[model samples]
Target: MITRHFIDVPRTDGSARRVHYRRCGQGQPLLMIHQSPRSSAEYAAVMQAWGAHFTCIAPDTPGFGQSEPLAGTPDINDFADALIDLMDALGLERCPAYGFHSGGIILVTALKRHPQRFTGMAVGGYAIWTPAEMAIFGESYLPPFQPSAYGEHLTWLWNRMLEQSWFFPWFDVRGEARLPGAHADVARVDQAVREMLESGDAYRAGYGAVLRAPRDIPAADAVVPPVLISAYFGDPLQAHIDRLGPLPAGWQAQKVDTPADHHQASLDWLLALPPVPAAGLVETPHEGFAHVVSAGFDGLVHWRGAVGETATVPAPGGAISLITGAGIDPPGHGLSDDWPAAAPTDRTVWDAVFAEVQRLRGFAGFDFEPITAGDPHHLYPDLTPDRFGSHLTRAWSVVRAGAFFRPRHQPSAANAIAFDSTAIAPDRLAAKHLALLQARSARAYHAAYGRTDGP
Candidate 1:
């Protein structure tokens, strides 16, 4: 069952704010932070899935929900500190986390200053606002604290918020033009608007809190944890999407076209990942493409660009010249210029890879992994392919009939002991693979089976 309680979290401002928080389920703790202009209430659906795997703890940031506001000034940094205080109070020394929008900003701040306190983080719609973006937001988001008239205030907030989100130029203009290349479910939009209206001044205060916030939230590269950035269509954060490209190596960017898609994707990601260990680097466009080709392995070769039949293959340690999609090598074609086709040719090549994986792994051919639930190769993306390849190549050394390769648990005892071969099954293999992927626990196996680790 979901459990909630009220507790006072002391701010650095020498005052305490009453925070409404909910904690549920068990296992490693997970702290969830809500975006500005919204309270922790937004994460109700997410908590259900996450709670199963984590002790999901969500708190209403001060000035939103039923929490008390700061008497003077507070910014994202302050919010981070408050979260730390909450963690200490709850006796959670370290916890993995997820956040949305402004909540993501706070998480970033916390990551930079107190990196050790968190296990890892997954965030949705981070806006690394530029100076110009800040100026635009200040005007619309940071409206006056005290409005002259209640009706005028409500109308003004509604128009500003809606226009900023749905129209082009966002804070710069007012129009009915749908944002360029942006789309959303009409019913969802209606529901969000209805909720926003119902929340009243608390929403306004949180909106202003983010609007007036300091734009330069420093990147905590030192705090290397596996971070996933998820974005939806019509999200204003898309404008600053490129800024997220150069984050900590362990960080990953996932773009979902709709809110519902983003929600589901995030839930799946959180459930799959564990506390990060080594600070791995994210793959840049060139590095990513190079790895895709050089490895000769296949799953997904994802790249981000708009409107281009032409693509450039990265040269050895350098940027290669631009060439047609058919011209470059992402495993699919040659430079015989073809006319514009209805669908992308790359999709066909990807389909071929899927088919190959299916044939070998004996699973369904699907775009994303987990081709079918309970499939042995369902954990394809999460499994470090290089390690799996090494194991497969050296199968004789690691395995014998009635005994499977198990990472040595400790160095002091029998290095490799025989286990019942009948117990070795596909589901057991999948579970073992997942346990190894958890960054923190991966090293725990090195003492046993000292096979080379891979990304």
Candidate 2:
């Protein structure tokens, strides 16, 4: 089973930075790094595939996922050091690592700086961008991506990611820049766009560092771990193997026919290497969240304050706490997991579920106040994606309305909420926007709650 975790790593400035990661399988430890604008979620399938031979550990790079962003503008070396920091925090003295695309760049940089920290590396693609190519990318590749008042950014985001699969550099549209496997897959594009939305403006930092990084490999004489660099036939970086002037004695680079072939080759190479014992792999305790698995439910429940202490669930457009002695996001809400199938329409089921959650958390009881929406249908808009991405605007409208009215769907004087400029600020609205996106089953959960009032 795959499990999520958080670890607090102390910084030089006496601050603690929390990192979120996914861990699965059990064997020798294998550290996996994902590409830019993506979280460790990208490696889910790969982790499952390699789980039999290695305990796969994949983490979101700083600023890109639930992981906190680095202070100020950080370069590629800072990213490399950040990876080392995570490894140190996890008590991993050394481990075999794997990376792809920009992930490979960070791993390569880490190997150069701290060769002893890794036994070996299997990099899917090592980019060696030419000066002319960098010049073109520098001008138009990465623009500042910030949320707009009306969600105009979503349109551009969808197109940018969609076309990325169509062209190298993504911004280049000429005949020569077109990729052989250009596609218009909506599901694929939607996933990529959602990841970008999750990263927000932080994408510029992580991706920019990759573009500005030095492309040279370590010197032939330098002592380092064995590295295997490979790219598939259709990959744009496949041509870069020629650009790699010379590799260290034990390093090798090659091209494969397909992604499957590349994965098999990487797996074969890593399996041949001497295995490192994964002893003393430590995981920090859950600080700000709790995991609950009860009858008909299994998911994470985020909470604040000490167990058994006064907990508060803040209500929308109201300052009062609805439930006391633990603020928990119910299944299918906030960061909690979605219901596996259709949500149970029975109130007794929900009551038993919450009871189990309370018991697991060691809470004696919870004080509940009835929370209702006047028009439940309109309260949660249909966020289904359309060709033009109009759902984004609809979601933004609901989020903005939430700040001004008691029942976000109704905006009369009776429902008027106190005007607070801070609440409507773009950053605040953007946060709520992200929360809405992440709450995949909010509509179903709300409907289930409403079904308790059967005719």
Candidate 3:
């Protein structure tokens, strides 16, 4: 089974940053890096496949996923260093690594800086962009992605991710820029959109760093670990192999016919390398999250504050506040796990779940209270995604209404509550909007909990 974890890596500034990762399978450790604007979630299926031979460890590179972003505008070198920091935190001295697209670029840069840190690398696509292509990409590629007051950004986000499969530069609509594998797959596009939303504007920092990164393949004479770089037929980076000029000894680049073939080739190459032992692997504890496996549920549950304190589950549209640190997102809400396939309908299921959480967190007793409002059917809107992305605006409307009224569905002046101007600010609403999007099971959780009366 695949599991998620968080580890705090000490930085040069005498502080620590949390890095979120996914781990599965067992054997020698294999570091997996994902492409930009996406998280380690991208490697879920592949990790399961590769788990039999190696302990697949994939981290969401800094600033892209739940991982904390580096200070200031960082360059590619910074990202490479961050990967090494993660390695050190995990006590991984050296291991075979895998990457795809932007992931491959970061791995290549890391190998160049610290050659002895990796035994071998199986890279899916290593981009070597020319000056002309870089010019076009730099000009119109990554625009500022701040959330707008009315959620206009969501419309652009949905289309941008959707059309990327249709065009090489995504924004370029010319016939020459069209991809042969152009597709309108909604599921694929929706996942990408969610990831980008998680990263928010931070996507520019991580993705821009790669776009601006120089073609840094080590020289033919430079000593380095063996690396195999391959790209599939429909991938735009397949043509970049020609631009790689000359790779160091023991390095090779080739084109493959399909994604399956590329994955198989990568697995074969990594399997041939000497295995790195798992003796040094360390289990690091994350500060604010706990792994809970209670009756009818199993996954990470994010919590804050000392055990035995006031434990409260936030309402349908609520999240654990940074100020009070009192609320916990129930299973299937916020950063907690999604509801199980056969999730229990009984409201008492939550009482047992919280009890398990208290046990896991070392709370003495069940001195807890759940905070809720409105009817379950009315409090949680059906923000299910549509092809046109109307869900984005719908979510924004609900979140915005929540600021001025109790049981946000009732927007009458009689239901209005007093609040500061900052309550309805765009940035604040954007945060709530994101929480709603992230809460995959908010509606179901509410349905199970039923409703309560409020002012």
**Per-candidate TM vs. native?**
0.52, 0.90, 0.94
| Candidate 2 lDDT by residue in tens digits, 1-455 | 66667788779999878887888888898999999888898888899999888899998899877788888999999999999999999888899999999999999999999999998989998999888989988999889898887778877887898898789879889899899988887766777777787788998899999889999899988889999999998899999888897789889999998999989988888887778887344554443445666667676665534567544432222111123345666666555566666666566666676677677666655544345555455776767776565666778888899889977888899999897788888877877876666556555555555532321
Tell me the lDDT of model 1 at 322.
25
lDDT of each: 0.50, 0.77, 0.82
* Colliding pairs, model 2: 311-325, 311-326
What would the per-residue lDDT of candidate 3 be over residues 1-455, giving only the tens digit for each residue?
A: 78777778899989998788888899899999999989999898999999998899999999887888989999999999999988988989999999999999899999989889999999998888878999998899999898887778888999999999999899999999999898877777878888898888999999999899888788899999999999999999999888888888999889999999999999999999888897244544433556777777877787755666666667655666423545566777667777566556577776778888888776554323343566666777777787777887888998888888886889998998889988877778887887787777766666666556310
- TM-score of the candidate numbered 2? 0.90
lDDT of 3 at 203: 93
Compared with the true structure, model 1 gives a TM-score of 0.52
lDDT agreement of model 3 with the native: 0.82
Question: Which scores greater on lDDT, model 2 or model 3?
Answer: 3
Instruction: Itemize residue pairs with steric clashes in candidate 1.
Output: 249-280, 249-281, 249-282, 408-448, 408-449
Pitting candidate 2 against candidate 3, the one with the higher TM-score is 3
